[model samples]
Target: MSKSLLLLFVAVFCINCSSDNKESDTPPTEEPLYFPPLTGTTWKTKSVESLDWNKAAVQPLLDYLKLKNTKGFIILVNGQIVMENYFNGHDAATNWYWASAGKTLTSAMTGIAQQENLININNKVSQYIGTGWTSTPIDKENLITCKNLLTMTSGLNDATDDVTPSALTYTADAGTRWAYHNVYVKLQDVVAAASRQTWSAYFNTKLRDKIGMDGSWFASGNNSVYYSTTRSMARFGLLMYNKGKWNDDVILNESYFNEATNTSQNINLGYGYLWWLNGKASYHLPQSQASFQGSIIPTGPNDMFMALGKNDQKIYIVPSKKMVVIRMGEAADNVNLALSDFDKTLWTKISALYQ
Candidate 1:
């Protein structure tokens, strides 16, 4: 109870409190932010000719969607936002569901694994997730591979949960035929198991870090991960346009990027790794039998490709044209709305600029 002792005690307490405050002030370490140099009036409305569209026409297409309730849409040309529009109270920053489009991210991770020498796409899924990766019948498990999952040719239909066998079983065998299903979902665990890191961690460190993607992982709790804002989706498309290179960094291995973007398997009309190819030869039809024909509207060349999602989350990459276009929003059950027409129309308006 002496004065000197009490004073010393008080001073020690104050120092401890100050130290705690300083520690609290320090920022948490996170993956650094990647701000791509993409902004300004180009994204805003401007003269069609001023922007370099082969034949830029969106008004008619916009008119077509006028009566429909949709989320948002963005259009970028040669890595620049040539046109952007929003609906349903959504904005550029809104995070819409990429659905199947997010699958491209998964496929991209596979490419990253190849770059790091984790595993090869030609490797069987069993090699990564172990034997019986799919909970399907015994016959189906033996035939699955990373390539099969990415190309949608795993031959195991998702009618019943492929993860949970209590659901249903549709087919067996690998290259017998093709049907779009959730069989590829199992690859998430396979990739994570092989890399020995959580899918989120692996993605953030491997892919997101390279391209400077700002989107968060959508499926956080259940081992499912997909995400992106319209702009982020555009950046992914641009990465593909740049052949998996961000600036000077080779984000994706050139060989893997080439095969992943090209038609890995011909199951669907146009399918590369998780990405989709759009060409006259593309035999796959949107849920609705939409046809994309014409020039001027932004589209992939005979070699053009795309990353398409369930709700119309699209990253269209055309190598020959040197163009990347991103469209994100609800397109009615992931159906293509005048996609063929839009591709043709936009190209017409954009083509004038090029000439």
Candidate 2:
């Protein structure tokens, strides 16, 4: 072959290789996060086919949810509803109780109060509500901080759900032990005292209203449970998925949000600031002192975190997938609080959709 012709052929090959490299180096465009309107029933949705998800797997998931007694179920991707279903006489307009999952709401509100200088989580709980709030001795009680309460490491007894002074007996030194106790509700009183506003009022002005969430705290026995439509719970999960931001608004600082989702203490690696974390090396359960080895949900994404409640209410947020899943209704199987066998089975089914 002629030298000039050979040189031209080599030049063409080099150009083609360079173009291929450029295409491979460029990052894929990500979908922008969506925020639904503040009012009306309107919400943006994406079809499973559009996302290239397993359409065949979708029905099985819905069937399992209904069979397990889920009244409302929603799956959001980048804040857009992808799958929503209602079962057993429930609909989008129906409100369901959040049970212990409502603890995440209190955690977020506490962070807001701290950012406004109304309270500091590191400070003793007694500092805001004054002493004698618990039956623990003065020095022992003083050792408990709002942060400890948020992490469920207040070392308080979990024998009773009651938070009255007479019932809040001590179990161990603050921060030295971890137990899932309803004593975290005292953080509500702390915020109320510090901000000089009722817990609901402060929550409305700072978090709920700002995010366009529709919900109200109601008295259930000794606990202040939150009841909201399924979509409202998804809204809160979306906010957390974005690290406490709604559109351009900074509702809670990113730093606090990170702390609230990650492990808050060494004792329970699977728990955060009222949030249940997955992918941890070890974890502790609601009423058990035994430390179990392995992630909270092995089938779930490593970055997933959850707001789990009594009777199977769940808000599962997976940052790796930019997905927020919500489920509300009675117990899926046997009546239980927070984590259950349902989680493992549910994730196994959910993994099929995106795997």
lDDT by residue for model 1 (10-114), tens: 999999999999999999874322326544323323334555444434565455444344566555555555566777788877777777777788888888887
Give the alpha carbon lDDT tens digit for every residue of 230-251 in model 2: 9999999999999999998999
Worst 10 residues of 1 by lDDT: 288-297
Runs with alpha carbons beyond 4 Å of true place in candidate 2 = 1-27
Deviation (Å) of 86 in candidate 2: 0.6
RMSD of each predicted structure: 17.5, 2.7
CA shift at 213, candidate 2, in angstroms? 1.0
Candidate 2: what lDDT? Answer: 0.94
Alpha-carbon shift of residue 43 in model 2 (angstroms): 1.4
Q: What is the alpha-carbon lDDT of model 1 when measured against the actual structure?
A: 0.64
